[model samples]
Target chain A: MGQDGSVPAYENASKESPQPRPRLRRSVEDGWIAGVCAGLAHHLGFDVRVVRATFVLGTILLNGLGLLAYLVIWALTPQALDGEHADAPRPAPTSLPRLDRAIRALRTSGRDEAFGNVLGGLALVVLGAALLLERHGVNLRLGLVLPLGVIVVGAVIGWSQLDRAERSSWLNESSFSGRRGVLRVGVGLVLTIIGVLLLATQERGWAGMGDAALSALAVLTGAVVILTPWGLRLWEKVKREQAQAIRATERADIAAHLHDSVLQTLALIQRKADDPAQVQRLARAQERELRAWLYGGGQSAETTLAAAAKAAADDLEDRYGVPVEVVVTGDHPLDPDTQALVRALTEAMSNAVRHARPPVSAYVECGASGIEAFVRDHGDGFDLDAVPADRLGVRGSIVERIERHGGTARIRRLSDGTEVALTLPVHRPVNQSLNQPVNQQTLPLKEAHDA
Target chain B: MPEPRATTHGPIRLVLVDDHRMFRAGVRTELDDSLPVVGEAGDVDTAVEVIRRERPDVVLLDVHLPGGNGRGGTDVILGCAGTTTESGAPVRFLALSVSDAAEDVISVIRAGARGYVTKTIVGEDLVTAIHRVADGDAVFSPRLAGFVLDAFGAAAGEIAEVDSELDRLSAREREVMRLIARGYQYKEVAKELFISVKTVETHVSSVLRKLQLSSRHELTAWAMNRHLL
Candidate 1:
């Protein structure tokens, strides 16, 4: 044994333990038909030739009783799994490797109680009898016996596949089993066809054989039609259960999101219920986030009076937790003059929303003549005459800014609401298209706010 | 502010139509006591029935309702098109909605509603709008003005150049709409544009007629549909 570190951990584990048990499975590598005789000889320390000869004789003397027993054993036994020896690399005896293999198989078999010992002994007897008959001069009909043997071998190959346990094991495990099953079944079918051809060509007609094959196919199709619905219902049930599991996982994800955001915000709002402003702020923030998440596709990127007003409105709403509705009729591209107007409008809107009852409304219209914006609130109107002109509340924020662009701002007190109207005339020279880019250097300082 | 309890004729009879029970209750409480609510309905069929039975001066129609063969407020407006008050004046519809969608606003307007106002409007402004609608005058909220300007301004641009006199906004009409969009009252818009208040109302009424009755503006309708869809 190399006993190197590269050896698999299982080999070391097997050596350290008392012994590694072997399972009662047919030998795939050594089998002539289904590997039953080879696996039996290996397990019982008998020669494989001895096992084979006994079965052949038993088939002749027992009137096919031995064949029936072999078929039953083949159906019950699992074929040796590929890589069984790979689990532990056993050292082979130098002179007699076959004997050593038998001994090793025997040793592994000893790890667990030997299964079907009586059946194994019976196999030895059959092989012994066949070996004796071969030694003697036994005259048999070669034509009849050869065809029957070939047919029986094909039948045995197909019968071995009836091991439902092994078939289903790899059927659930991987596609490799399906491929292997297809290949073996193909070989069995070819063998059976060759045997049938031989029997038909031997002083017989093909019509009878054709009739038999047609009848068998008809019976199989009838059986299939009668049995298909049971399998279909099983498949549908599996599919439905899979879909249900996926929906459950999605529900869990949504629940987690609600708990992390909505529930936490609700708890915070409850704690700050005494402060109406704080509660409103929290609730509004949560609602906006949830709506954006649900509807997807957040605000679009645009540089227009409407977009700027929306951004300003969103900012004020976030800060104060009050609703600001900004409605713009005609959109105009941002310019130096328009930028000044938007700044004044933002200031006016902030003052109205902050000091007055909401939801505040801002309306901006861009016509061929000019662009106008109004911020209105339905609170107690403020007396413009009472406010000092030196303060930055209205004069500095709204009136003076619009005056720079040769526009006007008016704070009118309506009977039901207070309105601040700001208008900026279209200043682009008649020659220039409104779509063309203008000189950016005229006002670079305030350009960042547009973004 | 003093509530206008009754006009020279009488307090304007009103019919309330909205799907949400809570919202209808809130509006009733917030409304001026002078505008006597004659009837109420929750869907289009009930609204048409109530309007025909009560002959209210103004019907506050919700844009999105649960019923009416899926057309909502538009169906109600069309269904009650022939209904009139006992005094022989036609019943008017004023749309109220929380939707800012241009399709919802334009559809109801096209279906013969006199005005459109968002639910966020102040109680006093809503009362004033209702009064104006009952008085056979068109009422345009700032948002509705914006939508109108957007729809008519860009749409039919090609057609407007070919025939500027028809299916297009005149300079005066554009100025009136812009002023209205700036939250200017009719009196204020007249003052700002140096026109009489009666002339301002005429401009607004003409705009409304062009918006609703113009069959030559197929391009406008197509553009609005494409923009909405």
Candidate 2:
């Protein structure tokens, strides 16, 4: 520990100290214990083997001072960033083939698997060293080794629980910080149990009945603390994969729709590009179909006021080769009353497009009060009363069509344009308990008018 | 109705802002020669720079653009908030879009645009709206009028606070908007409601001011849901 503290000051005064020096950090990837030896060897510009040999000899001859100093260095120095020594090679294979294979297995396994393998290998190394020293007539004390082993294993169990949440696969990015709290508490509880059991069994002989019971309890607690989170994480991963599969299915549905209608329309449009009328017709038809699919949802049979009016205007445009400007605001389902209103609007609009000048405007609005529409045209103003009975465009089609539905329609000629206004009240369910009168339904007239 | 209000100093200049090159060309060709194209821009940053430099009388701004931190046309209006023409008069903005979404309409209106029109409008009507905007009058298309009615009119069943008179449209204003939503021009609306065209303009302008200045969250949320429709 004293050497670890003095090394940085010595480096600061060396000949290469012209510039600011880098901070000392442990080489975790390269060192076997904690990278303290490798870090010291790099800083001192000495061979790592020489530094490691010095520490081992000092531990044997200097009353285990080297072991205490190594631990102190491990506590004081920070580990290097993850990839700092990624190019460093693994430990050379020992003459013992099985031990080498076990160390190699620890190198390539998952985090939890590597964790167990490292602990097992460390125990094996410690027991073999003790046997070797005993054969050399240097009796190692069982008292120090047994308690330290228990404490190190307990610390490893607690530390492994710290970062299981960081093992990112496709499970979840959110809820990880929240999951860490419960897992950390479980780890702390298991570590405390192991510590208390070790203290209580210290009076009994090591490897005796008390020790056996202590080990059994510690293993059971560790397994429970570890496997609960593992199972939960696996379940979460499965659920996320299922959600992804559902989304892929939806995408396939949309793709099928695009191929069936849109691609066919595009091909037809290309074949008739020389004829402007044919191309325009194809494009408009395709647009209506696509809009219905996109916004109409699943209810193709149900038509709203806006949809009905637009379809009527589009039909007129296609038949006459004339463009009609239709503007709609607010929309309601096309009930019987509003359907009558839409029919009246169609007659009024067709009159403006056929008998009047181009660029006529149609506007419709659906509101809480009722549905109101206007079809205006810039044409020669004519009086409603002066029109002959034979020409029933205004009287029979516009006015009477709406009056039959219990609504009203009016036509007025202004200085610059003629305006037709139609209004239909919305139908709301009557409450019988409130004694409200049910709305009277008007019978349909047999004569239909076409402008 | 041809050049009804004559400009003594020639036609009002225009700056077109839209992201699509084809749409800009189409609008340029469709516009009458009376409305001169002074400049054009494709994004919010270029729009602000061109408007500030050319000082056009009216700007036909597309409500959705590609720049300005994704706030799009609203950011252009704010970026040029205090800009004035060479004569020291404030420049006018007329927003245009292909869709009549209430949220986009309300946001652009609140950002101080004078009017909103759909891209499917007739060329003559677009010319008339541009002239109206340049003359410092608000132009409300049928859909926008209906949106205003839904937001501020009492027909929406919205609760009106005692102190929020400015947030509510009066009865006459509602009538005028309803007529406008029925595709009536201001002149025609004046004749139908037995009022002068100047009074009709006043009602529409007042409604436009309320739409821009009022911060009623309930009105905004109602417009978002399009419950009136």
Candidate 3:
């Protein structure tokens, strides 16, 4: 029996300890007639032949009740191959009897009207039986049975109509005012009137009318219940459409916003295409600005100072066709001030590519307190003090742009290369805001340098 | 660059669309002896109007222009083609641009331009590109062909898989990829790496196949996206 390779290792371990009582699971490999007796023997730690003999004796002694019990056990216990092992007790089985499944289906079907119709039909059958019994002088009450039958029919019709109206209420209210809603109202009124008339024609005249009026009340109550849900659903649908319309208008506003700002900037760029250098500078600066704005100005999780520095270096290399090696040390999200700092670094890189020779590199070091960038080039070094005033490439683009943002720019001349270092505090200065005109500040600096 | 071929048919009619008037004039003076200029427009709207009215055999299109609703060259192509070609025989567009940026190249090519060339191209090469595009053969500036291949050949989702393939490249192959992606000419890459141009070509093709990339342009974009450059 143990030679079966299909039995998992855990099953063997389970067989060694029988005190805790392993769960009952059908044996797939070793079993006759659905493995019920073998499974029971394995779980209970008894000889398989003894369990089988007991089942047979019990079946004969108990008038085949034991056979019925065996069938029930076979249906209830899941196969061990289905991952239900004797050592591991599973949660309550999901496999239900056929009768339980039918009850569950009826409860969860969501067809309330259909259920009501079925109950009404059964009531009608009972009413008809009672009427036949009365004709044979079986003493059945015709008045009670007839009124009950009329109420049940009215209620069923009201229920079905209400369910349909509620479902259709998602359509516009104007559409609901068409023939369908009116037809339902007319049918409900007619049924309610018929119920009242039936009561009036009962024996004892006006007093019988009172008793039959109860059936009319039931019909009216059912109709009200149907209409109430329809009204609520219609209200919800109207609210949803209003919200949708508001969102659509908001989207249109955003589209117009993009057209006014981003599209206009693009048009300006295209107009300046004749001056390739100006276009390149504008395109690079505008791309960074737009990315900062569109991505919410450093609020995005991915926008780090190191990433911005690397991108600026890459752009400069591609634009000028110069080789730039960028080394970034620390990473952190950038504020608008630091974004300006990065743009200034880009201008410095471009100057290095333009004025300096090949083998240019940028080093960026960011910390919690401040950030610094050094753009170094391996060209003939130039004296910073001797730069011409009209050469706004270094003065206007790098120095003033950084200084205006409460940062510092320093130029150092090496024996064979020049390095421009920029530093900025983590927080903006009290006097500096994002809207400050950096260009206006740079214009005066250009005049001072030129003078 | 290829040599200009003698045409068996009549002079290839052409329209020039560029925002820069000087550039248009330069191209006109260079190619006037070979291909006759039939029409011209500075922006997308007038470009479409002139190309449709003239029914030119070829149109030298610029990638970026004002007006035409901010879409630039793609708008001109669409305005002329609508859903399909209006002239029965489709009007071919040869994109001319100063920008060698991959996005600019890929966007115009995706909009169905017959070919693309940078403004640095000499007059003879420009004429050759025009002739090839008129003959319904695709032409591209050497490295620009890689952009078209990358945009159309590989699915966008497969680009993420390129990261794993980067590990598969040998050390020498990695050096060639970085240089090529950095916008180096094949000869320049060969010179920089001290290898023959043929050896560089072999390494490039091997690297492209291993990375499942279609062209050098895609390799550049892939490297740039991974920050490997």
Candidate 4:
């Protein structure tokens, strides 16, 4: 993480900063029952083979529980995740603003979400209506309404929950089979009850012959209607290509470290602390641990610096009661302590808040090495000589701060009010040394796919 | 280097808070006779609980602590950052830290400290700083003073002239000039100034011209250089 955590490492260390995070969507060509696995693998930067292998291993280990789970994913997952649709490549790293504009420009993405929610609401309504009709002695199987109603409800909620899983990255996990089972049983039982009600209506209304034809038509139409949105996904295609490219650029040693160690240790650390000191110690530990992990005996590419700027923001909020707004724009480790510097920044903020007779705007910037905090009160300025040597509101707080850190802090009267600034040394991270480009030992992604 | 003694401003009931037991003991030893000890705490959590109970007028704080003891747990600095006196009551903070880390100094102060004096402060200075902070006057050690001056200089451009101005005037000259600047004429300046007109004139002439100005208007302008007007 960046030395203090005020900065996001991904924006600094990664060669691919300009790229925004991927959205989950359908993929067309690599359709393993509508590309749910591919889309998930692509979104989270995992190998589809590994994801597929994980599912395979689990199926074997669990006596084919995994395969049964896969079939359910095939049934319940919204078909739009298939990659055959969207034609976009992974946009270049520098194209972020344009990408956001592109996303905003695309009316279809919002339209799709709106369509899903509307369908979900409609599905519930129709299912309720058909059951009511069935109770009223109207035949829907020989009739057209009841069975069609069940499919409609199933499609709507099914798409909705699938979207949730997409947003959460659940499908990328090796335990997805287990997770999908939970997803299905909960949703499946409800949908199954609706199915039985629809069937009950069938027995009361139409003959078996007409009911049979209508059921086939309903299934066909249901599949077609669900699959139509498959034409609009953007995340799927871009994710697949970039993922293919990353796998091609992958160093085996780096991949192994990421898979076998880092995440597990971080999960342990996240669980261990609740207070600032614990978090600070853990953050420092993360820095050292991540460094050791990076240079460990294995050959490595640049360490992944996906560490967030907001984690630092959260830490600052927790300890200092200071609100920090972070705008991440580079690649490097953004650790937890960097955010806490806002407390230092609020030296300006607090002076303005507590003592400014006529309140003025104060602006502050915090970074790894030091902080610059300044406040201007709109009220008035005073004589330095007449003013007592023991200026408490400021010198007690603002100026002494720099000395405490072996840095610098000061306050001065402008034409209007006082301004203060402080700078402190930050622990420099090894990731900074990686600013020099090194050749990535390319991965076998395209080779694996082409083969 | 002078030994500390109890002052006439009543007991500045102080709490010694730091994770380092020896350092806390040393401060307690140094200030025990000069300032009454309400309690002692060594971690953020316990320090917090102690300060809440004792309500000491002054908290002597250290920046770093062990056992998750630093920052907010029982630390008075962290606890007091958001706290203020209820209408009228006195609770102040004097930070005692070895760290000259700028960020830490700034943080403790922002976290509600009233003064910052280093651990290296002599027995007398530390006691004096504690009393001053308790009495609602903030204090900083000389080293921190320089840093603050540097920060101020950097922040609002420069104030070498103020120090230069002080250097240019003698003590008596400053006194005479103060009266003149307060609107006293040569005779009135001489009366309040406790000097003869020739002396006031000499002081005023030196104050005006040496401050590099030609007239009383320019003298006032030079005196008011920072725009306090």
Candidate 5:
């Protein structure tokens, strides 16, 4: 409903990009009211009560003229869920749930801000003031003719029609489709006729009609304030959202990396490696690196490395079928170097989440011996040699990231699953790693040496 | 129970309470003559009144009813469903909710509901469930039953553990320990147990006495460590 026609600011559908095809009906799994307003508010990012208030008031006012339209709209809007989508099939009727969610995903995506606060707050305040002002006015006031009228009309049509998909389908199918361009042409003609009528009635308004219009003419000049540096203002907001998006992608990328490549390779390495002592050493070494990357304190708005790890794990389990379990120690903040190391470990975990099968849980443990992480599955294990050589993550994310931290990285197969392990120094001094600026880009590894 | 084969049974009595006319109509069409819809009401007050008036035995109630999900229906199931027994017992209420929200489902059961079924049961399951509820059998959707049993089984485990622990301790000791563990600090535990702090301490000491423990930490730990927690 925002001007751009994206999902309304209240229902941030594309803001963080809603996860694919997970049927989330009004959470009949959890419903209080029709839960229609709640679902809309959830979709639009508005408080449910705010949506409900709008509906209640709209319904009371439009009960005579436009109520039927509202109900028709309700019957048109798709329910919050698809019931069962391709990603999660519906279970059989005879039994309990046999649904399996196969697609691996990450929940808790970056917070998307589709609407700014000031605009929303201003809309609420103005609506309230105008409603109060209407007490003194008689028939067809200017405010009622413009915004209030739209609110009444939209509320009646939008809220009711939003819930009824079949009505929408029928209208779209029966009316629009069969009649081809006739409906659109008819609607456009009606809108044009209304526009012409409003233009003709411009002089028929009430008191101050001319004087008020003259005074309003002065305010239009003040629009110069915003219009003067239009591109510059627009540029700033765009930059800000882009930066925010980048930060989100980086956080998401780190989670995906950990779950997919590093953990998978380490688990593989752990399984195939012959020397027990070497495996423990490698696993211990990888643990330290993972903690530093995830929990070690950093300049990011994100949490400590360990907390980040848990969030990543939770995100993995919730979004994907992969189950994640975490172990935290010494609730103290960890430095970014440690955080960076943990970031690498987190990537390994992401690899596991993506590649491993059922019953294979991603595990993370941090103690006095540094931090340790692993993705262990009971599914089929892959050969280290057979792993796709051109894989972007192993060459680019794992090896390159560990090398930057002056650590070693390895991948091998375990008896039951594959593991990716990378070990780095636990307590490297800030001065030693201070050669590069914090904002410097990570080096992309050359694929020629990866395999 | 073993999976029962679908039976060509006679019409089952059923009641539906939901505000949506279209959904109600759709449901009615699906089960038109397969089951006899004894009555239907769209709101809370009407739903309760209809159930009481018809006593149809299987009332399909929506969780998101006009007033609220199952507030009045739950009451009817728990406190007002059947005619007064010699013991003044109530009839069982079967809740029909669209959601499988664990809390709502359990609350209905705790309210003496005989069955809980979600609206997504399609038509067949919904019809079958009505007959089962009419027969006085407890019915729950497979997933919903899992949620019920998980909670019930956990509570059962706690009960078994508490019983065993009580058996493990002397009567007086068990009494004092239960009060203490229920968030009665030393002084409060003493007051409730009807003893002075000194006497309570002595009892606590002796209870630790029988349990073979030392220090309050060890006593609390001993109980917790023994899974008395």
Candidate 6:
């Protein structure tokens, strides 16, 4: 403890040195006891055995002053937490170093049993010294004193070496939670009863009973003092975990917002920069879309078939260079039917633009029982039978797509062009809901539309 | 109706039609002083009225507009066809559209447009096209000519009779002719037929003579008119 005050002076000397300083920390990897010789050898750039031999020689020549100095250094130096020792210079092999190596081998042989062996060795040494003193007519009793000193030294080493969390858990394995608290109280009460009964049975009177009671009260108070701080610390840890979870959610929201708004707008600007008119149009459209998304304007309940058809036409014109003219007459259809019809119409219109000459026209009308649409093109038409099997534009996209929606597609060739007329039933079947399976129906006129 | 005399040295009378005002102004500024802008209109109704009132020699028309069922250029062309010069010469229309789509090209050409050029065409080329259309010669952007040929060729399939001239070519010459008609360059035709460029040239000359055609463009037009492309 007296040598502990000199540690900061050595740390300061190492910091002030311009040359690379070998850190003067205790070498737990290659050390006897507190590794004072190993630490000095590492700092002074000498072999550890050379430092140990110098210490042994100096202690013999200086009449035991070297041994006291060694103990002081051992108490002062800190263990090198990072176990590395290669920085120091090596020395020539000598007999003394060889003897030190043999000693290290013996010390490490039963390393796992080292703690109990060391304690037992100290007890034997003290007992032998006491017996020798008694034989020389000096009375000494070491039974309780030696054991208590050993315990005190062990506690001091443990308290200095263990980190904070490990020390806390070692102090209270059963934290002051409900079940453990009840168990601890039961054990304490049983011990107190046993202590009081022992005192009464031993013919120790009221004074012994009072002493036992006071000691019990002191133990309970000590437990309360220790457990209250631990409970507060555990609560703080839980709160910190909750805060981290909330921060993660907030970061996710910010990422989503950047992806939707800033990144999408930048991509649009890059794609449409070649044409100024197109760039302007895209900017205006995105502004409206963003504002609608931000201000909660997209929640309107009414989505008409006509408006949807117009949007699909515009999208087609934007994607493919073909233009379409759509004319919608009468009221909007039911929402589910409207969606189905819009999809079917988009497919038919896509077919017309791809296969036929365009300037295509779409006419939509809603009647009492059903809705109808006609997509017409004035291109050079083909024979219905002549359409190859691989051509899905007419057969699959137009006919099958409409039929899947409980609708019918009729293709007829006029003298100048071809027209596809689609009719969708407004009401579903009696037993079917909006989300029911598709109804597959066959048309009678398979050989139609020779355009 | 009197025939408008072809004046060689004078500027062609032109009416510019477009929905975008800035685009119209840009075109007006880009055109040389030789081709004067006679009038401008944004929609189909106004365009037709302006064309009839002005009776310009060439009408530069945009294919899409707000009025007249959204087929603005075709509508203007069809409307002008009814009111011609005293000599029965129709007002020539040159479609100037941003869209180079096959459908737009074919539809306007079918509606009596004498020429079609996309908006990407530079000022000099557009001026040349206007002059050619005003002179009663068909003018088209190179790719747009293909669309025109396809549309009119398929329409005339029933009326056209088989020509013995195509049969006169040898098989190798015929292959060269088909490739040349489809707009392959001479070197491309040579590589495709696994023949030398000189051999391809020889075949082309022979095919041209047999068909009584003058150039590659004429051969393409003749083949398309016969629905052979």
Each model's TM-score, in the order given? 0.55, 0.64, 0.36, 0.29, 0.26, 0.29
lDDT of candidate 1 over A63-119, digit per residue (tens)? 664675566455335557776533332223234436534633653353221232323
> Which residue pairs in candidate 3 have backbone atoms (N, alpha carbon, C) closer than 3 angstroms, thus clashing?
none
How does residue A228 of candidate 5 score in lDDT? 20
Residues A1-451, candidate 6, lDDT per residue (tens digit)?
1122223333453355354545556665566655667777887777788889988986787554456446534433345666456554433323254543454456434232223234333443343235333422432233223322323232223223323332223233324333443444345444434433332233233455455455334433332332333343334444555767999999998789869876787798898789876665565455434544554334442377866776777677666656665555444744766676787788778877887875576766555567777777656766776776545344555566566678888887754456777888776653225444333333222445443
Candidate 3: deviation at residue B204, Å? 12
lDDT of 5 by residue, A105-184 (tens): 11112121112222222343344245424523644444434433433333332222222222222233333432532333
For candidate 5, give the lDDT of residue B2: 18
Task: Please give me the DockQ of candidate 3 compared with the native complex.
Answer: 0.01
- Largest TM-score belongs to which candidate? 2
**What digit string (tens of lDDT, one per residue) describes model 4 on residues B15-47?**
888877877777777875658888888777777
Local lDDT at A423 for model 2: 80
DockQ of each: 0.17, 0.39, 0.01, 0.02, 0.02, 0.01
* lDDT at position A59, candidate 5: 64
User: What's model 5's TM-score?
Assistant: 0.26
What C-alpha lDDT do the candidate models reach, one value each?
0.64, 0.66, 0.59, 0.46, 0.45, 0.56
* Runs in model 5 lying further than 4 Å from the true structure: A1-451, B1-9, B67-72, B76-80, B83-92, B99-103, B146-229
Q: What is the lDDT of residue B172 in candidate 4?
A: 60
Best by lDDT: 2
Which residue segments of model 3 deviate by more than 4 Å? A1-190, A193-237, A244-348, A352-451, B1-57, B60-91, B95-112, B115-229
User: Candidate 6: what lDDT?
Assistant: 0.56
lDDT of 3 by residue, A98-198 (tens): 44335434543423323333343344334433443343344335444443444443343334333322324422243453366556555655655555455
Candidate 4 per-residue C-alpha lDDT over A13-101 given as tens digits, one digit per residue, 9 for 90 to 100: 22332334344443424534445455555545676667678768857875554554443343334444334335434322332345433
lDDT for each residue of candidate 3 in B84-179, tens digit (9 for 90 to 100): 223345677888875544556666765677667767666766787787666555554544423322332221112323433442455565455444
TM-score of chain A, model number 4: 0.23
What is the C-alpha local distance difference test score of candidate 4?
0.46
